[model samples]
Target: MQWLFGSDEDILKLVGRRGSFLSRIGVAVGIKDSDFPVFRELYYEFMEQFKSRYSVYTPRRVFASVDVRGILIDGSELKEYMLFLRDFVNDVVNTSGLYVNFVFASFGTSRISLPGKAKPVSVKTFIESTLKSYFAYIPVWTVIHRTGIKRARVYVDSFSTSPETPAWNELCNNNEVYVVSNGDKVNLLISAADLLLGYIGTIIKLRNKKPDISELKSYLKPFGFNDDRFRIYHVGNRDLGHIIYKDPTVKINPLLYRPFPIVYLIPELSPAGLLAGKDERKLIESSHVYEYILRYVEEQEGSLKIISFTEDFKHLSAGGVVVSLGEHSRRIAEYLRLLGFPLEHLNARELIHLYGGDPRL
Candidate 1:
């Protein structure tokens, strides 16, 4: 099956008692090609409804880009914004033939700086960097890896200047990537991406305020916005590079489970447990091991079962492979190592090569 991916960004500059800073939010959505007609119908209906309510004309292509910001101009318009988003999300979720997946990344601009340059980089450079680090490479690779699809098409709303870096070129070489202008006649998914970006940007702005947004948060839960699909790299004054919020109940490649179980021993304060606080970087580093193992098992058609380091050994089957993640589980790893299992610090790629196997598999 073919997948269409679209991306857009919302940049916000805020000034408060804590001082002024910038927040850049990039959102991407992936939809099946078979579902685009239904999505287009829903989008057109929403635009017509919006135009009737506000008495504002919404051109076919630029409806979301030009009109979504108008809904955020004041407090009174917030109600309409919430209602619009609520109805849109509800309708999309209830639709039978549509499958939409969303992924968003937020970068806090306060602690960002070039390594050697004294002066700051231009807005275009920042945009390119955000796209490279979070938007382009990871999102496309995640889709390809999860779906086992050979190729997917990506349509990014034009940033005026296209990225020319080697990473960007490599991405294009691997998949069909296009940077299309807002007025592009065939790029309907870009408008959906823009709408999502605007809604998420509003959530970031009001999250710290006294006004409660429980209802808004609730609306996004169905879209998996509060789950693994959402990632916050940096926010406010903190440079939190590794704090990823993912639901523990969600397993990687749920449908590809085999009877042979690979047990993963996690730290007591693992990111999956939502307790990675100040040790987020270390925890995230160790998470790569779990990710690698999970991917390997997925390719092997095996299953993975996660357990805390302090959990009992009752769940471990005889002669099963057990792997420990993070420094906190070092002792357990050592014990398992002595029992003839693989090392806890093993690299899956190197190990596969050592066994004269295909590393890609």
Candidate 2:
């Protein structure tokens, strides 16, 4: 119910003060921190609360390009999310500046071209193909320029490429100004989603605090953050469950939502869905995807489960499956194979992409 703003100073002051109140309230809820119970509790409480008070944005900004080395038989599955990986490099370089860091790794699943033999591909192949694919997306480079990203570096598998490959030389040429390989230790390792989420939430609250303020909000404009539908808020202690127990619309469907009984899965959604957006509420709903997503969560007893988003699966049917995906959903499909899930264990999305037709157009 508090007014949200987009100023850093104003937002920081507000969050800095409200931090304690949130800590006490969060414990009352069910949030527990592994290391610093008090600190983690408070930090989450603050983020959720701040999100409630303001808008949060999660941009898939920083990324490593991945290349698929082998052949593919399932055109649909091979190309499903693969388009994003293919164009990702050009997208970053066009949008970012000369000094940004982006790594390229061997990516994609082995099942796209195998006889039930899902081998773990090398990181080198992913990086190589990703850069090679970057060439196809150059026409849209100007559009990215208008969108305000300013830097990019392609990470490569030094062992995978030929001496004469353009990607190798391009990477080598830019080592001083435009690139960083995978092994290099750099200052930024944060998820693009997390950074945008926190940044947007804080900025929105800041704007609300000083309705007349100018400056910080301007930075958001270039990032395309000023749009009206992107509503955010700092989570009030009582509202934390909105993420765990209810949908983004605040609707509850026990059978289809979280905290509901699901076999072999734990539920987690990208925090981006928690913010205001059109129809994004579906991400939090208890559907087949939620079923598998939950099972995956339950499987991760102590490790972190990453939630990645892509339009790759958008072309699929049933909106996709319920299953455990690794850091990348594509990898999850492959990892499941290694874990002994049947080849039929394709995610709902994979099934759709493989056998289902496009419902959007």
lDDT, candidates in the order shown = 0.48, 0.25
Model 1 C-alpha lDDT per residue in residues 1-361, reported as the tens digit of each score: 7777766665555566766444455555676688777877776676677767777532232346445556545755676676576566566523523333433333435234443447766534554453443343334434444455546677665442322333344445666765543312225566666666666656656653321235435555654343433333222223222222123232222112123444353454554565754475355434433335533443332334454434435334343554444445556556666766543343344444544556564
Per-residue lDDT of 1-361 in model 2, one digit per residue for the tens? 1111100000122243334111100000011113223432333343343334434221111211121212221453544223332232123212222112111111222212211236633323322332233221111121122233223222211122121222223323432111111111110111121223233333445444321114434544554432332222222223212112111232211112111111222123333243443233354332434333322322321111122334223222222233432234445555544655433233444322432323221
lDDT of 2: 0.25
Locate the minimum summed-lDDT window of 10 residues in model 2.
22-31
Error of 1 at 289 (Å): 57
Native-structure RMSD, model 1: 21.2
In model 1, the runs with Cα more than 4 Å from the true position are 13-21, 53-62, 71-76, 93-150, 183-186, 209-361
Candidate no. 2 TM-score: 0.19
Which RMSD does model 2 reach against the true structure?
Answer: 24.0
Model 2: residues with Cα > 4 Å off, grouped in runs = 1-195, 202-216, 222-251, 254-361
Cα displacement (angstroms), candidate 2, residue 114, comes to 58
